[model samples]
Target: MAILILLTTQLRAWSQGEPPYITLLQGDSIYVGNSIALQDTVFYDVLLKPTIEKTLSVYNIISLRINEFDTKVIPDSFQVHVKVRIYYADSANAQDSIDEKTLTVTYNKFSTYEGKAILRLRGAHWVQVKVLEVTADYATLSAVLPVVELENRMVINRDFYMDEEDDAITTISKDTTTLEDCQELKVYWTPSQVAEMYDLEWTFIDSSAINAGWYNTGGVKDPVKIFRNNASRVRISSDQYLIPLLYDGKGALYYRVRAVQEKENGEILYTVWSDLGDHRFTGHETNLNWQATTTFAEEGKRKSVVQYFDGSLRGRQTVTRDNTTKTTLVAETLYDKQGRPVIQVLPAPTLSQLIAYTPLFNVEDETKEYHKGVYDTLSGSSQYCSQTSVPFSPASGAANYYSASNPAAEEKEFQYIPESNGYAFVQT
Candidate 1:
């Protein structure tokens, strides 16, 4: 009898060819084939036959019964049982043991179907259902919906980060990284395609001052302390950042920037930092008294001295000495508060001591020849003293010359001579 039953099952499998591919429709969702996991109680099923066109559509009314719940359609004396396996760690060995439970399903009236369908599954982790028999008046159906327990799994999401090609600022070079004067240092950057603003970070590493030739001969080093206080100043797109008044021009500065975006609901997002840029610093202070001394090699024994008072050039003196003749020419200029030269002291004249005044000349001899006096012919040591008028004031004139004998004489007052276009300085 077992041999006869195996022969009959083989013949049935051969006649059926492949398993039936059915489509279950529940509202807008469609489930296909025998691998369907039941979601709603009511759905329509369509039997798809495998032909040359694979186009045969045969509708069969399927009634599924599993998980202690059934559809609204009343089955003709139908019963269902679910095979459940609960796994637990085995105390005797390293394998897991299974506990089996056989439970019968009950019919419920919560389903409303437009057409005939079968799927009465609920509360099963891993279930596979199969239908056995069906009829008209006395329909007898047999199905197995196996429920198996599975291990829990955790999922992680991977993020896509930015690359160096999307950096916002240009590379640091000699032309862009030198800080020489008291002017504000401006750092420019390219705009990011995805960012609305940017966050800036900087640090200054104290090092030796740059040489007078504007060369950063001082060695560069890594920064030990970072200035995060400036990072809070988030800037909008394409805006140039001016370094704050925090540097004293005694060292080098390092900067790195990143992109930032803000959502409509006030959520901020940040990106990774860009490459670090190094900038060398020279003197940029303004409020202190300073002096500069320079010696020239081409001009023999030439030296220039410049003095500044309250950030303004106060005095400048150039000395040129002839080492062979033991003579020196000292020309100096003194400036007022407005940076205009107030006094210009000229070099003393080196005139010959012999004079051409003839003491024996007759008092009325018209033809007697007498050379010009040495004092009258030679230029004297004089200082050109100037008084600059105040801004928008009415007076102006030429500078006054004071001889060495009357070196203490004050500047002569002058008037503003009105011209066709503007006022001219007229010495009175």
Candidate 2:
């Protein structure tokens, strides 16, 4: 890799009064393809590890510029051509002409002239600038060309295990399995040339929505990092029950890997983070217990009621009519004692008595009957009622049924279904 230094120092003679030559100005040495450094030189030549055997190394000339020089007599025009020849390290007779390109430079006396070169391919070879021709008088040329070396890229692979058996990896196209069965995870990557260390990090996501605030906001912890001692693989185990049980039911775990290369001179280079690998963990067997309250306007009064239930049973009900409120608990008929269900009974108020004092008790008075017996006093005739004679009822029966106060708390029993990984209401 050639270092580009911006011309800050005054122009100095390359040789005593031999027309000060121009060289590389300011620029950093760039790694070719990989993140490792195998050799160190002022301008090091990079050796690319080809994916296939018997392949040639490819080179690209990113940017070229003329550095320091005396601008007394500006050259009208100058031509630059790169000559690259490849030869086997074992035999000099095995030589081949790989690349040759002639570039025209727009010369400026006071400022630098930027030029671009076409890509070239050569197998373990040497590169040199051959001045094809110079067009102006007293137009001497001095050039500085940097050689860039590309590094070998790395790839990561992952596998999962449960106990001593290897678990089949789950993918988007594959069916999801329970996480309770998995106890270990392994992540590995192909070793990169010039890489001295590797860094791994991972995090867990509880839902599909990405919480940017969870990662960006203060007080949030960073992802867990695991360093490897130049090893190509790492294993993580939750055998001791280190993995926390997810109360939210299910979640996904994501991980990233990167290679780190440090030069002997204390210079550090890092590869970008690899693509994210995600694993979904299911089989959250915890019971859910919650209560919901609903409120509605009735007879110029706001009425509210609450219903509570657990995973296996409906537990209680509470009702509020205006300022008065009442609660009824549905006693469990059976209790689990050491896996044995024992029968028990506790006396509690019935549903009718609980709402008797509330506005719900007057629901029947507010309801209207649509059908009526027709008897005209003026005509003194008995007949079926017409639409006009029929009592008008605003579909009040359905609404009144829900509004009626009940003290006997209803109970619903749910059975867990392993195939669906959920519960179903079996009896109410």
Candidate 3:
């Protein structure tokens, strides 16, 4: 079977096997305020209960409850506009505010979801379902049906084609055992005719050296660690993968193929981050054990850090059919660590919000990135030891955005200025 490995630092509940009370699915949360009490809308699921009337299609009665939340401190009146709608069988009822009151210090979204309806507060983390009554056979609930979260995981086939001319290409299987070296793999993929829709890259590797190759990836005398025109491709497609690179070069290579636009910054794209350098040409063709890994970072860097550290890398992809646009490629990521993600430190970290919003003038790239480096005099001057955001490009209008140099955070705010029909920033 073909596999795509992804790594991230986000916390998600995956079969945690928590009690029904603590086990919250999509659309769920506890409403707590640090101010006065307020009311918020909620949603629930399908339930079978004795309605005041007879059989009314798929419907249930929603109730209103008022209470204070855990937080909602002084001045900040903790209140939410409560609305309830029922979703049964297929459709949902019109949105209606059942109650509007102060924050009720309690974890409510849980029961709501358990009961069936999902809840989503304006600008909140998740949506939850509202629980009304649950019987062995039937369940009744009162909540506004909500949009489900996007499931963007995919199984990819990374193959190589002879050239863009031929349509028939052989898929490089991952189960061969011939231990050897295969060089100069040729592959082709059309961005126009897409299969399942995803991003595509031609090169991949397991990991990189602790602190090496920030400029060019593969080249002699090119100390900049910059990549060649075609290092590799991070891609996705509905058709199978076609590869011709495994015929001569090393057959054993680590390749990470995932869906395009399916990952967030700081999310792990693949696994294998120990002490190995990025292996661009480790192709083992005959054995079927073809594995390749890639390393990403700046020069004078210790390791490749996460692109953007969102605590959790997995995120929602734009909802579209499986055949839509082939795929909308987003930033791809790969992790070489173990366990779930909660925002681990990248090999080379980046800037935080402090410097992101900072103002700058003149620049080529709209965003500026900072890294760990020496500054000031050898004496006890203002030289940062670990991480700091300083002037990267000193040219006039050269620095537009700010970066802390932390790779995981992908940390840098854009200077969005309305241009003609699009927005332009000094840095992006």
Candidate 4:
């Protein structure tokens, strides 16, 4: 390591005595590779730790000057160099003894405005430096005496350590296992060096579309991109991530992973996406209900209906529509014991089955509510209301309202509120 001071011109060259001069702008006590840059000069300070293995040190001072003098002004080329003498001083009186007989002069020539001069001073102890002469083509200068102190300072190893960003070298792969007789997918990857955390992105496409050649590309095309941003991406510290397997139909999911390093300067650096993998998911046992349509012999006259059931084969909901009449009807059934409504917290019966395989209650003498209502075709306005528990128990002193199915009934309209718990209802 070496201490360097750089002086250069920022504008046109100055005639003889008006040339810019270099000075010590700041303190010399600086760590290795520390630098200070001013308008026209730059300084580099180097400090080495104390060790018994080495003794000699080198201090380099570089000065650069631009000689923009026209070619017609000076017929011959110009030369500029500095002469220095290195000698030890007596610590008791601090007296420097220089021998002119052993002094040497080094000439550095500048052919263009981009030339630089380097002055190397090597010593092992406190040395005194005296610029005996500075030979320039245009400037008449005096001697320059600069006393520089060179000392070996001790520093901790941590001062020399720097953090480096890590690259994601992990190979991402998928794992599948039978979960409640349904295949579940899990993504895992290998860990890399210096990885503070990881980012994961995934997207899916229907496998049927690929098989039908609907996509022009030979591989997965224009997938439904999900988790593309930092907020949505699975930012996890662990190497493995698991997401709920929602099987709408047969589909293949593609995913990638990358490592991230957060710097102390509040800047984040991320590695490139390195690992690409895919998982093919199929129909699960949870998908048990489906839809079908039927048509009549008359034109523009048809009926379509879809029926949903619970895991115990109990009817849950039925939606029916008539094309000729342009009418729709929905009916739902709920189960509870002793007039107390049963709450189905889980949306899918298979999910509820996974949590508790056995049924909790078997209602023998259960009370039910059949709500039916209708309104004019012009009355389509409705307002939202807060959700509260419906006191189905007869002891609550609430009247039990019931209505039977009327096939040819037409007068009032009904609006089903999905947010209602325990039982779905339609209000007039």
Candidate 5:
């Protein structure tokens, strides 16, 4: 019964004529002479019949794979050639063809030949493989061609926050005069194509080193630190970062971003790091003060008064001795954004006017005298003397006599002129 079964199998194989060729499609093994029908005609089984007949009339064939096989008979010494041709599904016109290949075979040694070709199928396309001619023995071949869409490319666009101050002033310099305070740093990117996550790498260097050309000369190099954001975004604060302040006179932060994507095969793909973004500290605030001496005469007495002037918060205050009397005079001035005095808070005396009623006091003896001057808004001293003007009390006998009852309190304006080591102010 076993021998009969084997003979029957051989007879069935002989009846098929051509050697068996198998193709793998979506992990399913399909052989020639068997056709798979679907709603959409994707792949079809082609049989090499004596008289070719039209098969399916549906979708296009995108990809195919044929397993390698061997010829039943071996050639003595000559070579065999095989050729493959691809064509449009609906037409007999050929799209592509592979030239014939010579096959090598020997007695008692079976030789096999195989070929494969993949083409991106459009609306309707198919492939055909055929043996052109055989000098001695017949050869079998197989192929696999998959139609797939290409992956989309990724792009990264980064933005760095340099200056978020109210003035929107971005400082970029190595000079001490240009130093400013920066507290927060932010960075974000776009076009996260096919990325499941992202990573941010940051580093910093002292501006002093850069100023001295350390980078160009291969001096100390800063180490990079990486942070996995797991998303295409990040906002770094002062606590999370050790960004240097401009007040330190030598700090700069640099950063870069990259996209990560995972594949079905457990492989990961990373996009190239984005261009480096940098922020540098440039300028800071400084405190300054100075003193000036002046002589005041009143009631036949001349007294030298030393005045102290200090600048704070875009304003200035002057403290000096009242002229003619041993009293004290304090004047506070407020400045606007344009550095012009907008308000003046002059001292009002309660006891000075009443002193004239005393037996030794005379009404004519009260004389107003201007001693020290007020500073212009945002004015400072350098190394030389700076000329500044203040609201001065008119001469003793002048029509405008500044008294305690009528203080010379009015909005005064001045312009600061830059000079050597100091600022010269002129009343405007």
Candidate 6:
């Protein structure tokens, strides 16, 4: 992709022997469907990938500025048109030649600042760039150049096994069983806890290749935006493409899905796939278990689901109450010949269940000491940002302790959960 260095570096160049001047301005979000308002305007393009495709290649964006003193027209308001020629340059060098992504930019213009995502640099040097777009906000006086190839990408695909127990009885049979209709999707990846630019891609494929296009977890449908700054709409394919998400032995990937099967005649059917009311308790109060039942309100453009710890616990209350907090967990002491606290890790919640489900743990108030052991630093490292109300420690508390649920910068309080191998918790 032909990315613009919208963020300019201080470079002095004399063109007509006058005082040298240069300015750079980057572009903002470029959305889909005919138009997505942008912070800048420039050449743009996109790569369309089919569902279930494991690998994804890049695209390009290119633009030519028209000077006012010379061309005498505002680029943003004028007839702005771009012609792109794509090429695959293995070398970051400007001298190499390669395959093309898009030969011509088709039906492109900006309604706002920057309206495009990828551009192609043709003729001189076809360099594949993966970042930063040029918008009308940029100084047209400054000369524009092709972006250089910066890095490589290993497209990681995330897969999760799901079963809708609530719909089990509605199924015709075992193989012809009914499952929760999917709505929103949450991808949780651990990027090896390293610092790297991860391009996330999200595609929910049903029986074969049909993508699940419906309301996100937050419930907003129209103007559904996918951009860099949006945590929910990760620029990459899936949120959980990193190490921990693949086969971490923890709560595997879980996507909040909502499905709506519409009839040609106009009747709307709400499948188990709907996420219109998925929520958790947000108040300070807790359920019978220490776990909070009321969840926080949806924040930002995206709503995500993360598996904080290995066990996505589910403690079914044989009873119910508004104030389930301060209740104690009852368990008969059962142990092997050796005397020890008996415990084993519980299975995680399913995608269908998690959308409307709250994590249920059996930890008593006394066992609350585990929160202290949680070490905010360690717990923060692996959280799903969009799924979590937590936040990373700007203090650089190191990896394993990153918390996406920091209350200081967030609207909700997320309980820190740490993972263990054999059991969800161990007794002293």
Judging by TM-score against the true structure, name the best candidate: 4
The list of candidate 1 runs beyond 4 A from truth reads: 1-186, 208-224, 228-234, 242-246, 285-428
Models ranked on TM-score: 4, 1, 2, 5, 3, 6
Tens digits of per-residue lDDT, candidate 1, 296-326, equal 3321222333333433435444333332243
Q: How many residue pairs clash per model?
A: 0, 18, 154, 4, 16, 69
Residue-wise lDDT of candidate 4 within 291-377, one digit each (tens)? 434444332134555455676666655545543443444444455433332433222111121211122121111333322111112
Determine which window of 10 residues in candidate 1 has minimal summed lDDT.
1-10
Give the winner by TM-score: 3 or 4. Answer: 4
All models: lDDT?
A: 0.33, 0.30, 0.24, 0.38, 0.31, 0.24
Per-candidate TM-score against the hidden true structure: 0.26, 0.21, 0.19, 0.32, 0.20, 0.18
**Runs off by more than 4 Å, candidate 5:** 1-182, 217-248, 263-267, 283-428
Worst 10 residues of 5 by lDDT: 1-10
Full-model lDDT, candidate 4:
0.38
Candidate 3 C-alpha lDDT tens digits along 359-394: 222222345422222222233454436333233342
lDDT of 1 at 143: 23
Worst lDDT window (10 residues) for model 2?
Answer: 419-428
The superposed Cα distance between candidate 5 and the true structure at residue 231, in angstroms, equals 19
Q: How displaced is residue 46 in candidate 2, in Å?
A: 11
Off by over 4 Å in 6: 1-76, 79-87, 90-114, 117-428
Instruction: Select the stronger candidate by lDDT from 1 and 5.
Output: 1
Task: Say which candidate scores most in lDDT.
Answer: 4
